[model samples]
Target chain A: MTFRQSPTRWALADGRELLFFTLPGHDCEPVPDRRSLPQRCAAQSELRFDRTTGQWVIIAALRQDRTYMPPADRCPLCPGPSGLTSEIPAADYDVVAFENRFASLTEAGGSAFQLPDPADADFVSAPSHGRCEVICFSSDHTGSFAGLDFRQARLVVEAWRHRTAELSATPGIEQVFCFENRGAEIGVTLTHPHGQIYGYPYLTPRTEQMLQAARAHRTRTGTNLFADVLAHEVRDGARIVARTELFTAFVPFAARWPVEVHIYPNRFAHNLLDLDGAELDEFTRVYSDILQRLDRLYPTPLPYMAALHQYADTDAQREGYFHVEVMSTRRSATKLKYLASSESAMDAFINDVRPEAIAEMVRTA
Target chain B: MTFRQSPTRWALADGRELLFFTLPGHDCEPVPDRRSLPQRCAAQSELRFDRTTGQWVIIAALRQDRTYMPPADRCPLCPGPSGLTSEIPAADYDVVAFENRFASLTEAGGSAFQLPDPADADFVSAPSHGRCEVICFSSDHTGSFAGLDFRQARLVVEAWRHRTAELSATPGIEQVFCFENRGAEIGVTLTHPHGQIYGYPYLTPRTEQMLQAARAHRTRTGTNLFADVLAHEVRDGARIVARTELFTAFVPFAARWPVEVHIYPNRFAHNLLDLDGAELDEFTRVYSDILQRLDRLYPTPLPYMAALHQYADTDAQREGYFHVEVMSTRRSATKLKYLASSESAMDAFINDVRPEAIAEMVRTA
Candidate 1:
């Protein structure tokens, strides 16, 4: 697949790369970042290992100062006038991607995060190393991904695919995650219809669990776990929300969230990079449909997290299954599902809505 | 450990068991539940297993209608007058424990939950058979646990131990969790000084991970994971917030929450039931102190979840280690730490505070 326009790359004043993705034949004019900015953040972040569960926790103390609920006019994600500088240098662009200023992980720090000392193995510490990028879906600040036209949505998908493929090739990035946090109810600081990409230094905890489960399933049944699950959901049909030629959207039988939907491509793929032109089109269409349906369930736009799960550098592509989990905290029109004791502390989930019932709602809506 | 007064048990109007726990040698008055109540919840909840992760999720659809922040005068946790019948029958009490009216899991149902059928292995589901109970820490409507006197705290500990032991013995109860969600910020619907006991039908996801890590540690290092973690924290000293003769409170090396403290007894105990008289006393003292320190860190009482994790029925006593994880979402004086895409979706936590700094603040506070 060829894009209408190649991505134009530029650097911000703080030495962070910014890329503008435009449609074929559209021109992105060069605009320099003139605002005086620091070369790097004053605070440093690191990762620590928890011996009990063997999970890494990020400590980015500087992130406490991240912009919260900025005014729309001053939104850093939006295009600005000559005197007003934002993260993006372009006055207007189709879709833009830029490195986060207050990033939890950074590539400029070092070659890789330093491993924990062997003497104090229990108190393991490592320098936080990776990359974090913000992807603006549209130049219009008030627009959402669901509200984007087919061409705009397709462009965003292409940009995600391009980034996933490119970031996966980065020196020490083990996993790449593309996700969106929508609605202020879910603590989204910005309302500029954007998502983020985190090229993690290590495989995420949830991804590790998924790989383990898939390996176990392969050992037991000698088949792909994702393929089997998709087949089962397709055959069962009750929890299937929507389906296209190449993708199937279904609510998992044991959904942890109140409003949860997982979309799986019919054909197996390690990540977005593996998808061809047809698959990308199908994904964009089904994903947009799911988002619209979620919004229709309530009078207002649903507050949700659209998390894309894919393989890491270490894992074989066949062993990992790429899926999109769209989970909303809204339990009802006026209520939200909070991660309290059972969920936040114990990782056990007590959901108030059944998957089959939610599937029905999604189908009707 | 011998209590000053044995628990006095009575049946509520709904046929749920209610126990009154008082200081030693305190006489209890007999109060009967005269109000009409439903024998069981109007809605039935079920447990479904996700084939992908092999985790059980509870589906309690009727919980959407559960009580929100009710008025102080209509508080179900507070003691009621003769005409205004609350969940508790007594006019006033030191501490009381009773089954939840709108329980997510229940024992009133049939035997154990029915096992999933082989035919529908992918979408397996069962009745959510377990118990849910509320433990009132104080009779005052607006009281807080941190403000409770030492005697009251001791009674609450005893009540927790009592419930843990009894719930562990119940059929099909894999794990017992005692927790309290304080403040509206953490989604606590009730402001009453109370905690909850959840007799989970399956071992929680976090406990399973801990147990797996412990077993792995035993295999690889020939030692206990929890014991070694605690000893390492003690030896490190920097992260230790407070320590007594028998217990220690410290921020974990990989603390996930902005404000998190884990209290561990110097000695090993599988669950609350294993604690002797001295250990119980020490636990009460340290737990109360940590709670107070957390409250003092902020100008107002901090919104937090105090979770007591204990052994599962399937695991050997020695293989499990009981600990208390007190986590608060407060990142600063005004801003709350939100678990957006990373933490909620990928189970990767990015904390904005250093454990050592928090520990120093905790120690000084």
Candidate 2:
């Protein structure tokens, strides 16, 4: 089936943009946010360059008071009815995306700024100029994205694709990240099943590292690093969790977490925007399958973070490949593998479980 | 008064080396480990090079079944008496250091290995070659490092200094990291007041990044990066938690954690070995003071990780500086700041508390 999405845009009471995405047969009417929200204050967030580690750290003190885990009946992501006011004004919706009230970065008008020279000053900081959005998978606040139907999941993917495209085009936005943090174990403040999208003004440390590795790999082996790695995973069937015509999911050879699975398109693609409708459909199926497998691994659902690594279509990013990494801190049914001194202080990770073992278990599940 | 330590060495039943450090005039006699421990097996830990990010990951599956939170009475770290046979055989001790039973790296006597070329093969792995040790702060096991008396704290410092010197001289060892994970919130498995020292075979990612930055700083400004940073922290004074003649403790300008403080020596030192007798004594005093202050920040003891970054005394590491970073996961008395998607997956940290504010709280704590 050819999947399609229909998006209708509206504004919250505080003038934050909200977009509702629906399947072909469904329609969304723009409803006014009746809740009385204070006027949006100028973001006090600042991007400070850490001279010691050569990385950028975002300081958003206002987020300390952001909404915590509210009751299911009073979840802010839920659609608001006649009396109960929520972040969403509509009584019902399919998939919705809106600006976060307490965001680390906001859409404050600013020109694209370069990383300040370390020798220029001992301390360097600039305005955190970007955007952060929350995407709700379904109006039902209890179920996770894995529980969504195929059509609903497809709509969510469409929303992600749209946002990635739009955010990538925004001025001063260098990278766009879409990720979901599930369960309180991973510090998901909100209980509702939702994900976050961030438009970062600078390249993240991990991305930069990967890009550098890829460039070096290309120079040494004359092939794209990610593509070569994915090809190797496909060739080695031991770590393969699931393989479809359009995509493959496997446990990384050097898996950092107890339970980690990376889903990659069978063909090379820069980001979600590069995928066709059929590929997205297949991706949604495989991605959901992996999440369900992770949930079934233990008695309780796995607490995990699903991150989508995408890149722009530029010459510098020519070797980049889009993939999804789903890793869980839950090592066993009752125990969690915490990042203690070694992992937290140093960037060295010691995995308690072998990738091959986890892959076998996930494949069977 | 001048301070000195006397270290006595012994062996556990399984042949693991154990050392006891006591204050001057306090003698420790060698005791036999009466426990019928199984013969020491070769370490199963393997270091796998992650091609995507060019980082090595230690895969130690045996660590999954390592001793967890055992009962207080059965604590292996406690000094054993006549009936009980713990890791420590003596009835009491001031400070002790021993090999970890479930070490991630062991002295299997492998020659120094280089990072396998990513272009050489699809998978590259080597034996995890190094040492992992546990340092008990006190034999009482009830109080924390902050609770140790001045003489006791000084002994612990002496033990760390000795370990750093010996481990640095070990074959294939690239870095020595001394760290403590305090409180269960930070995943301290044992209730005993202790720390760990890892003699990593490879330079950690963070250390590598810092060194690269330092190299660039020296080339651009003809100055040491860490020294310049410490000078700036002292000049700014706003983020200073404490300052002494030999050291300065302050919150980094771009602190990543909610409660983060860095203690730097006034003179540039590559590692603990560079410090003299007086500097070590002063460090012990200042370090203990900061820990006490951190404990007073909240009604409950703060969950923190104290990491001591040390480098080898070599021409390539001339710009490296020794410092201690003590950061807490506790954002508030009742809240914790978990590394979510941004921080964990992308290496981008979004801190909820400002550095200056945290410094103020620590200053008055």
Candidate 3:
């Protein structure tokens, strides 16, 4: 029942071919001593693996949540004095970013465990030393990132750049991921218009897979993998939803989701800190176009889970290209794309819509 | 630009990987043709592949709707005499299980594709033969399965067994998956106390992966893979949440999720039909215990995703054992676990808590 102290491997039910990156001891022991529960829970924080196409998912157990739609009188993110939280100069903010009070990833040191097998009796700390931050998309608590103007989005992007640089400077910060969760449907506890930043201690599985693919591609083709992809999608225009000099928002031909989208830089950049002023405009405009289109697609605002990816700062194997991934649950106004047994267990997707069709519907004003 | 008529695979960001799935080629055309929105939406659907994980995802542009959540009052699964709907039997049902009107998998035949691949955009449907049945867990629409009484829950399980057996008898039906999705947090459209049953057309990844592992194990070790694992878990008591002759539930060492539990039958049973009479009491008690513990752990009911694993009806792969998987959200009542960049892009997990601590907490009951 000894779980791997680090990312390692485990035997599947067959017990022959070892599943790679298995944090072993999580299921080492049985809880009741009888072997298992009728409906017991797995003591897993996350399961990092590579999909055939190269996506990553952290199956962390303790996912961080926040309070959403709070009263105006209770301002948590704002500065102090009359404000319950820290306050700032009373002025219109264009996508202002800030540090989060509570983060799953933090500079604060804590014991993250490599859980014992449900059969085992001991636990080991999973070595995850990282930092977490929050990016305020706007000072106004009501509107969402989509509702904000392009300028506002750009400022937000700048804040991301600054934070990336700051976190990268941290000794243990390996990867910096920026993301947002909107709407109560997806368990967004806080209604404050904000996004999150997580500086990982090591490379996440998806990034590792991508890096492996990139390295493999580079070996075979002698070219940057993402650069070729960007060029191909831009020239092809088959799945391109929106485009600008800096960024191109498109629904990938092989969409893992029904309403999946990627807003990547046409020219490859490793992190937010790398984008210049002119590049920033392109990023902002394309993102704004996608957001606006997303809003118009549904009468009511949609709930979405999105992230900004970057290379790990302290990992041994770190080859990541920065990109913004926007996954909206709004496959339809009401029908969500739940990852059922087949999808979650087998890692397959049963998308109900074509990426091209959805791309065309991307409400580009 | 021409997409597959059925499932197809395409290259991803990296050339090394491929994305695969069936997405009807609704609006696609020859490399040169770029039709407007309506024209494209009218094309046949096609499937796409994910290169990273070699999984398939579909895109039916025709079914694409801006909105996904249907109005609660408009029950789509069961239509009554009110409009163009059919009603269930007038008899009182503790938990009703019925075939879905608009099923994703139908008995209707399609162009047959090969076994599987995400890169080979070569998926042709094979009579898309499968059944989708809904299990009404409770008469009370607002109450979730957690709120069900022992009798009601047992009835739901019975309904699942009946439906699984009935649906699995179909010629091509390989797997019978019975699952309940509650709470809008997990993107359940209908708030009604109902679950879903999918009699799959082909062997899902779970069965396939395990079958491969088992075959490899038999080739190497000359023994049952699950047999030794079960014995080992029985020997150790730490990770066992609960156990019974009919089912032994434990947290596996390599748990990818926070609170993931697996319920395995002491006997080698591939589906729910294998359960006898008295075995269900233990099942009911333990299941209830697990739910009670989970609900108690969190002041309110926690949001979790789970699946009842069944075997792939493939002749050689029937040796696989069925299990129930429960991955509770790693979120506390106040915060949510965001599957951001590192998680969504990478297949990795980082836990904030240890399983031993969690198991200790769960073991209290």
Candidate 4:
């Protein structure tokens, strides 16, 4: 089947942009937002440079009053009925993306300045400049991404690709991250099935570190680092969870979490933009399969963070690889692996479960 | 009054070393471990080098069955009664330190071999070679480190100094980290008021990153990074939680957690061994003060991780500085700030609270 998506853009009561991605023949004409809403506070968030670790930390004090866990009937992500208004004006929708009510970064222009000498200044901070969007996988409030059918999942993939392309082109945006935080254990404020996309003004620490290592690897072996890693994982099949023609899913050699799996396309790709229709369809299938396997690991659904790593097509980031990393804190049916002293403080992870064992379990599941 | 501590060494039933640090004129004569115990398994943990991030992750499958949250009477860190064989065999003690039975690293001699080229090998692993010890802050089973008196707190400080001196001199140890994971929220298995000390074989990722930044800072400005940071914090009094004669405790300008503070000695010091008698006493006082303030923030005590970062006294580590970082996951009285997708996956921290506000609250508390 050929995958198709038609996105129609609309506006919320508060002037936030909303986009609906519909399958072919499922055209969406969103109802006009009628509820009165107050103007959003300007993004007062500041990005402070941590001199000790050379990383930027976002201090967004205004997010303290963001939405907490509300009842299913009160979920803002759900489509609105005639009497009750929600973030979405339409009574039903396939998949939707909207600007977050409480965002860490805003579209308001904030100029990045040259950092002063460390000896002379106490801190170097810049206004957090970028965008944050909420993507609702489905209008249903109770189900999860794992429960989505092929068509719905494919739409999510298309939506992610669309957002990535658009956000990357936005001014002052250095990176775009798409991720979902599932379960209350991971502090998911809402129970609705949704994911978030962040357009960061600076490169994340993990991204910077990975790029540095990739450069070092390229210098040492004269080969692409991520490509070599994919080849190595394929050669060493001990940790392979699933190997398809287009992509390979495997538990990494140094799996920090008790359950961690990374999915990479067989061919070199920098981000979702590089994938063709068939590759994106296959990615949706593999990603959905992994989430189902994770859910089957325990009696209850697993709490996990699904991270989509995408890099821009720039010369500096030419070595970047597009992949999806899904990791869970659940170590057992009843236990959680907390990031305590060693992991949280020193960034030295000590995993109780072996990578090969977890891979076998996940593969069999 | 001048402070003094006397440490007496003993061994557990499994031949693991144990030490008791007693206050002046409070000598301890430990009873022998009479219970029959099985031989300890050698450290089977392997450190796998993560090529993507250029970091080593410890994979210790043996720790899977290690004790979880046990009942109060069966606490392993508490003193044993007539027939019960807890980890501590002694009837009572002021403060004690003992080797962990479920150690991630051991003294059973595993050699670190050179890594094969990444292009040729799928994984690079070495036997985890180091030491892990548990330090109990008090004999009372229910009280916490914050509840300790001046003399007791002094003894704990002295014990840390002695352990740092001994561990740094160990052949394979590269860094010594002393930390406390308080409250069950942060994954403290036992309810006992205790901390852990790890003699790591390699430099931690955080320490390495800090040293790298320090080197760059030194090149940019001919001054020590940490000392300059301390001076900067002192100059910016807005984030000062507490200031003493020999130490300054403040929430850093780029605070990561909702509740985070760093305690540094006024003068430069590489490790606990560098502090003199007066400086150590003042450090203990300031640390205790901060913990108390954290406890008073809400109706319930805050869950926190107190991390002590100490470096080896070598030319390669001259830029390293000794300090204590105390960070709590709690954002409000009822909520916690979880490290979800952005923080956990990308190492990008988004703090909900402002640093100056938390500092003022802690200072006033």
Model 1 Cα lDDT, one tens digit per residue, A185-241: 888889999999998888899888888888888988899988998998999999999
lDDT for predicted candidate 2 compared with the true structure: 0.89
lDDT of each: 0.85, 0.89, 0.56, 0.88
| Model 2 residue B184 distance off true place after TM-score fit, in angstroms | 0.7
Better of 1 and 2 by DockQ: 2
lDDT of 3 by residue, A1-365 (tens): 12233222222121111111212223221111111112212233333322111222333344333344567756554322321133222223334343343445543233442322222322223333466556667657788888877655765666666667766666756666778877776656677787777776666656665676677666767876676666766887877887765678878766776667788887667776677767777777777777767778777877777877776433333345667778775677656666655566655456676677777777352
Consecutive 10-residue window with the lowest summed lDDT within model 2 chain A: A108-117
TM-score of chain A of 3: 0.73
Candidate 2's residue-wise lDDT over B82-190, tens digit each?
5245899887888999999989988733565555665577998878888899999999969899999999998888899899888888888888899999989977789
Model 4 lDDT tens row, A173-290: 8889999999999999999999999988888999999999999888988888889888989998999999899999999999999999999999999999899888999999999999
Tell me the native contact fraction for each prediction.
Answer: 0.90, 0.95, 0.45, 0.92
Model 4, span B1-365: residue lDDT tens? 35454478888888898998887777676788887877777556888889999898989888888888888878888787542568877778888998898888777224542334434566788777788999999988898889899889988888898888888877778888899999989888888899999988888999999999988888988898889888888897999988888999999999999999999998889988898888988998899999999999999999999999888768678898889999999999999999999999999999999999999999999
Best by TM-score: 2
TM-score of chain A of each: 0.96, 0.96, 0.73, 0.95
Interface Cα RMSD for candidate 3?
A: 5.8
> How does each model score on TM-score?
0.96, 0.98, 0.67, 0.97
After TM-score superposition, the amount by which residue A249's alpha carbon in candidate 3 deviates from its true location, in angstroms, is 1.5
Q: Over the stretch B129-153, how does candidate 3's per-residue lDDT look in tens digits? A: 4555666665454667767777667
